[model samples]
Target chain A: GAGVSQSPSNKVTEKGKDVELRCDPISGHTALYWYRQRLGQGLEFLIYFQGNSAPDKSGLPSDRFSAERTGESVSTLTIQRTQQEDSAVYLCASSLAATVVRSSYNEQFFGPGTRLTVL
Target chain B: GIQVEQSPPDLILQEGANSTLRCNFSDSVNNLQWFHQNPWGQLINLFYIPSGTKQNGRLSATTVATERYSLLYISSSQTTDSGVYFCAVDQETSGSRLTFGEGTQLTVNP
Candidate 1:
């Protein structure tokens, strides 16, 4: 089975530029999540989507960060006017379901991650 | 938000040895998982134990949700086992959002 996949394994952009990272979750997965991992640091929750419900944007660091998922398949995280502080590895993950009852047992499959560098 | 912490931020071990990694959380959680971030930057799911103990080959994990802690044990460590180990949890208040620990950087030398 195909695991979650992310595009632009490596991205280099100048400060103030905008970038979009893509994610392809495993087929049939109803939940998708985005996270950021700074060098030698832990994963920081960004946003999540479950089926067709409204996405969870509470974790978005600021207005410059936003993510969208269409039909529970592909997701894109966009960072507008990126700053050097935004440099990090963007990771995507997915689960079978994310309802309150089933979420406790869902195992998230992660993508290889996209390393974004802001110079 | 629940606070998660992993002890011994870094560890160095010799091949064929054994080691234990610990994770502690500040509150109750409905889900607890262990992951290994390989040298190539791929996150691999190792365990999905919210409670009880499970073993896979030389690796095993035990999560005591009641105590808000978990332990991962590796026996006969191999050079390929060198990587960052992370513990993440989904608190009752956070639905499926996983709060991750700083991770334990492990280095296994042959």
Candidate 2:
């Protein structure tokens, strides 16, 4: 089985620029999530998508941060006017389903992540 | 919003030893999971025990939902076990989303 994959393993951009990180979830995964991890820090929730329904964008830091998923497959996290504080590794994960059952929650798989550097 | 806390922010252990990691949450959660982040920043799912116990090889985790806490245990630790372990709780408030802990940085030396 193919694992989740992200593009542009490393990205270096200037402040105020916009960056888009893409995520390709595993086949048949109905739920996708994006998280950010700063150096020496924990993973911060960004956004999540379940099936064809609207995404849960509550974790997005601000209006500048947005994400979109098409047909329960690929997802993209876009940070507009990126700031130095936005420099971090962006991670993506996917699960077969989003049910909160005791057994299903344990199966989320993750991608390698894209390290974005805002210089 | 939920708050997650992990104990012993940093730990140093010798190979072949055993260790325990703790995670506490501020409120009830529907989904509780443990993850191991390697040096390369890849998150590996360790356990998704919202309650009860689960063991995978030398690692075991238990989540006491009633107490709002979870414990991860590693026995006969190996050098490869050195990494940051995080506890994330998904409280179904608006949607199923995870709130992560600050994480516990563990270093296992051979």
Candidate with top lDDT is 1
Which ten contiguous residues of candidate 2 chain B have the minimum total lDDT? Answer: B90-99
Q: Which residue runs does candidate 1 get wrong by more than 4 Å?
A: A100-105
Quote the positional error of residue A10 for candidate 1 in Å: 0.9
lDDT by residue (tens digit), candidate 2, A17-65: 9999999999998889888888898888888788756457778899999
Question: Which candidate leads the pack in DockQ?
Answer: 1
The model with the greatest TM-score is 1
Candidate 1 local lDDT, B1-110, one digit each (tens): 89999988999999999999999999988788999999999999999888899999999999888888999999999999999999999887777889999999999998
User: Which residue runs does candidate 2 get wrong by more than 4 Å?
Assistant: none
Question: What lDDT score is found at residue A38 in candidate 1?
Answer: 95
Candidate 2 residue A7 Cα shift, in angstroms, is 0.7
If scored against the real structure, what TM-score would every candidate get?
A: 0.96, 0.94
Compose the digit string of candidate 2's lDDT tens values, residues B5-78: 99989999999999999999988887888999988888898987888999999999999899999999999999
For every prediction, compared with the true complex, DockQ reads: 0.70, 0.66
Candidate 2 — what's its lDDT? 0.88
